[model samples]
Target: MQFTIAEIWEHTGLFARMIIFALGAMSIASLVVMAERMLVYRKSRSESRDFAARMGAILAKDDLDAAANTRPDKNVGHLGRVINSGLTAYRVSSSSKDVAVESVARALERQAQREVQSLKRGLGVLATVGSTAPFVGLLGTTMGIVNAFNLMAAAGSGGLGTISSGIAEALITTAFGLLVAIPAVMAYNFLQGWVDARSVDISESSNEFLDMVARHFGGSHS
Candidate 1:
């Protein structure tokens, strides 16, 4: 009637094993997303910081040509793209100051939206895994209990061996589910926070860029 950990898996029904395997797959997916997102956010933060420092110095001198000439660090920083878009708009627009500011503002807004979308990539997977993993485990547990009872019925006796296997299956699945879900939830929250911070930084950078344009071009804020 006694079972070791190895014996538990050996006795686990096919359906229960399938559930555990599915949970494993979900865990792997979450981990992959987490690693990928971390790398992206880290690069974005570092590049954006460097861009901000350099651009700040460039903007302080109120040099339109220099600001417009600023190049992104090999297409890393979102701020670089935003500034480039605005500057391009400013240069191509009609000589009217109002028209230039409006164009720049529109370009910056469009670029900001694109950057935010990029930052949000792969986050939905984290959310799905966090919210649904437990339910997947619960389904396994339920099926395991049912299988145990069916075995007991066929054996014509309520024996410990017949029931213990099912109980173990249920408990193992629930534990595995929690293990998978907890880290996923944590990762989702952390990454979401990182995205929010990046958004704020992008917004601040856009605002500062717009303000500089207004100051130099004699136009009100767009």
Candidate 2:
């Protein structure tokens, strides 16, 4: 019997329907996380580049105050935050050059950790959903096969139509699962690359800041 879309929906088994619903929810969650993370990474990358340029010039002038003041107000980009943290520690230990270096080093390390964690926010969800979605789809497919067999057994003389309808309905869940998972996986990979690049930028900025601080204090302490 040929079935219209509405009839197909009406005949969809409860298990298949539930699996489809779950896949839809996962798709929504992945999309939300992907959008949020993209914005955050973009902001961090843009602001950090600007902050680095400004701070480089400030340090060139031997102006520590100017470097500290280079902290951007719009968004505390990774570079600004790391520099601020190290500078704060350096100022607190200004009495001794060695102590100041040690303090800044520790502060930068802690701040870097926090920055990495921030960059990774929402990534776990994307990864989890991506990795599990295909399996979830497979499970739905298996359930559909089971359902098809059961329907066939119940309708011994009904020919192929009895099992074919159930099989067809079940396959839809597998397709839906793949649709949800593919984009999620792609987004996760793209975002992960951005996070890694940003992390490198933050690390380089930290090292640059430390070197500047050492040079500025080395003259006085010598």
Candidate 3:
């Protein structure tokens, strides 16, 4: 089947609406993922910095309580929540210091994992959209092309204009799909890295806090 540029443009116009809709959905998802990840990373960085400063002061004064209380919420991100859990356990485990340390540490680890998962939320959806959107657009494009060819055959047109519209529609959808997928994939990867790094930072900071607590308490609750 032959296609003229003008004919292609007309055929693609029909699928343009659907492609626009898909692009809109993909854009919203990507923006949400980007915004949420940025917020989480920013908060985590601030908390980590504040906590580090507080930890420095506590170390300088050798004050366990001060260290424990120092910007407890501000010092840590979601990881702070996990550390707090361990700290709480440590305090309660005064009766069995040995067992308490182990149990509290384990509990904190679990909580940390949960927090990491929370930080990573919505990433999967973004990734899915990115990975599949192109193919979906391709499908639309293929359909448009097929329809154009069929129409050309039916019309027995000598001019390329007969199938140009359908072909154009097909290309447009494919292009739209790619445009949506690229950013989504990039955002998903960037956020995933940020979340992983933040999680590691939280884990390390929590470990330091736990160690300080253990050392001050003579490795076990009295």
Query: How do the candidates rank by TM-score, highest first?
Result: 1, 2, 3
RMSDs, each prediction? 2.4, 2.1, 3.6
Best by lDDT: 1
Candidate 1 regions off by >4 Å?
1-4, 159-162, 219-222
| lDDT of each residue in 95-191, candidate 1, tens digit only | 6777777888999999999999998999999999999999999999988888889889988999786688678877788888989999999999999
Q: Clash pairs of candidate 2? A: none
- lDDT string for model 2 (1-222, tens) is 456556656778888788888888999999999989888878887887776676667777878766565545656687778888987777677767777888899999999999899889999999988988888878888998898898777777566766877777777778878889899999999988988887887788788878877887897767
Q: How many Å off is the CA of 142 in candidate 1?
A: 0.4
Compose the digit string of candidate 3's lDDT tens values, residues 74-146: 3476755776676666656655555756777787888888888888888988888899899888878877778
Comparing 1 and 2 on TM-score, the stronger one? 1
RMSD of 1: 2.4
Clashes of 3: 9
Colliding pairs, model 1: none
